[model samples]
Target: MRVSAKSDYALRALIEMAGRTDGHPVSAEELGRQQNIPHGFLQSILADLRRASVVVSQRGQSGGWRMARPASDVSVADVIRAVDGPLVSVYGVRPEAVEYNDSAEVLQHVWIAARRSLRDVFENVSIQQLADGKLPAAVTSRTADEDAWQPH
Candidate 1:
């Protein structure tokens, strides 16, 4: 399944936050500049993230955005869901909600399995681990697979 640009940008912005050294808030403009995401798009993405409690925002001359919790507490899946809803969906419906008959019934299982596989990586990957450049063994193993990097 294709990941939408919203999910991609949210993840990139969060990853940029994960890499911050200073505790000061990061302005949306700076975040967009650093991550190469459009400023307007980043603002919308940040609004969703803030609503989800993934990132906190402040107001004032020195105010901007910062993580609501530590980087280790936030998973990539969390950010994706905040911006894009479910990690996997068939058409616009959730995998489990899709119905089919006879031979096509087995197709639901395929979608379920796809969601499971995606969760195994996205849920387990913390922003801290991403910032440290040390992915979990499961994620590392997948990356190590020669086929994983190949274009479909």
Candidate 2:
């Protein structure tokens, strides 16, 4: 599963806002500068987040974007879905939505497993964990897997 640049920027933007939740609203310009996201691109991404109810925007003097809910309640999955759709997908279809025949039937299990694996990581983690520089034990263990990067 690959996170797109848009999703990366959205995560970063969310992190920035998470850190400053009670401080003040953060402008897209500031978020872009801080996260190095393209300003125009950030606007569109922010708009998506806004529509998803993940982030709320304020207009005028002390205005910008802030998390609609507490950062602790937001998951990485939420941000990813808001910006990039599903956490895991195969051939543009959800794992549960696809059917297979004969030998290809095994691929359904593979897709379900892949989606399950991704959810294991993405769902257990909340935005506040990232914002606070902490990750869940399950999440960390997956990262620490000695085989995480080596070819089988």
Candidate 3:
């Protein structure tokens, strides 16, 4: 599965926000600067997050953006979906929605299984966990294998 820069930037921005303890909204400019995300692209990403209820925006002198709910409640999968739609899609449709000929019918199962595998990691990880620099054992265990670090 390919992870887009948008998703990466969104996650980084959220992690920065999750780490804040001042109880004040973070300005987009600050988030962009800190995360090294392009301001224009980050704006669109923030807008998407707001529309998904993953975040809320405030206006005024001391206003900016903040998570709509607890960081622990927002999963990586949730953020990905908020900005990029479904976790996995083939030809712009869901894996299960695709119809294949007899010879290729089994391919649908591959796509579905891939989606499940992605969910196993993405769905289980939360922004709070990332902010705290601690990943779940289920996730960290997978990285214990030295081969996991080797490129194919």
Candidate 4:
């Protein structure tokens, strides 16, 4: 599955917040600079994050955005869902909801397994881990696979 730019920017913006101390706010401009996301796009992404209660916004002189919860408590999947909705889909429908014809009966398991595979990584990875440069063992193991880094 392809991750949308919206999800990508939201993740970056949140990571910017994650990199900061708890309760500290970082402005969109700063986040954009640090994350290499565009300022205007960051604003829209931040708005969605704010609406999702994933990030809190402030007004005035010291105003900026802070994560609503501790970074460690927020998973990458959380940010993805907040911005991108369902993590996996089959022809635009949820994996479980997809119906397959007799000839494609085995496809159901394939879709379910695909979503499960993605969740295994995305759900276990937290923003704090990414911001702190730590990765879950599963992710590390996967990345460490000799061929994982090879461009297919």
Candidate 5:
């Protein structure tokens, strides 16, 4: 499945923030500059994250945006969902919401399983782990096989 640019940008922004040691907010423009994302686009993404309670916005000169919770408590899945919608969707519909003909019914299960696989990785990983360049065994193991990094 293809990940949306918005979700990718959100993850990058979160990772950048996760690396911060000063506990100070970072402006959208700064985040965009650091991640090479468009400033306006980053602002929109930040707004979405704010509404989701994933990031809080601070006003005035000394304020900007910061994670609402600790980096360790936020998962990539949370940031993605906050900026982009569900983790996995087919034809704009959730896998479970789509029904198929009797012969093609198994396709729905395939989609569901695909979503579960995505969840297993995204949900299990936290921003802190990402910032620290450390991933859980389950995540690294998936990439243990050379074929796992190859284009299908």
Candidate 6:
């Protein structure tokens, strides 16, 4: 599956926020500068995150943005969904929602299984884990295979 730049930037911004020791809201400018995300694109990402309740915005001198809940409660999947949409889609429709002819009926299962595999990693990984630079054993184990690092 292809990961969008929006999802990558959103996760990077959230990880930065999660890593902050101070309980201060991070300004968009600061987040953009730190994460190397374009300001305009980041603004739209932040807006989407805010609308999804993944992040909240504050207004004023001491105001900025903060997670709506603990970073541990927000998964990479959640961040991606907030900024993008469903994890897997066929022509904008969900894998299961897509109809197929007899010859292609089995292809739907491929999409569904692919989505499940993605969730196995994305859903299990939280922003806090990323911020702390510690991935779950389940994830690490997958990377242990030598072929995992090799390009397909």
Task: Let me know the TM-score candidate 2 reaches against the reference structure.
Answer: 0.93
lDDT tens digits by residue: candidate 2, 1-152 = 77899989998999999987466889999999999999999999999999999999999999988989988898988889999898878778888898888979899898889888888888888888989999999888777988986866
lDDT string, candidate 5, 79-136, tens digits: 8889878988888899999989999999999999999999999999999999999999
- Model 6 agreement with the true structure over 22-125: per-residue lDDT tens digits: 98999999999999999999999999999999999999999999999999999999999999999999999999999999999999999999999999999999
How much does candidate 4 score in TM-score? Answer: 0.92
Error of 5 at 56 (Å): 0.4
For lDDT, candidate 2 versus 5, the one ahead is 5
What lDDT does model 5 reach? Answer: 0.92
Candidate 4 residue-wise lDDT, 1-152, digit = tens:
78899998888777778877656678888888988998888888888777878889889899998988888888888888888788888767898898889999899898889889988999999989988999989899999888989988
- How would you encode candidate 3's per-residue C-alpha lDDT over 70-129 as one tens digit per residue? 999999999999999999999889999999999999999999999999999999999999
TM-score for all models, in order of appearance: 0.96, 0.93, 0.98, 0.92, 0.97, 0.98
The positional error of residue 31 in candidate 3, measured at the CA in angstroms, is 0.1
lDDT of 2: 0.89
List, in order, the clash count of every candidate structure.
Answer: 0, 0, 0, 0, 0, 0
After TM-score superposition, the amount by which residue 73's alpha carbon in candidate 1 deviates from its true location, in angstroms, is: 0.7
lDDT of each: 0.91, 0.89, 0.96, 0.85, 0.92, 0.97
Question: In terms of TM-score, which candidate is stronger, 4 or 6?
Answer: 6
lDDT of 4: 0.85
The lDDT-based order of candidates, best leading, equals 6, 3, 5, 1, 2, 4
The window of 10 residues in a row where model 2 has the poorest summed lDDT is 17-26
Worst 10 residues of 5 by lDDT: 83-92
Where does model 4 exceed 4 Å of error? none
Identify the candidate with maximal lDDT: 6
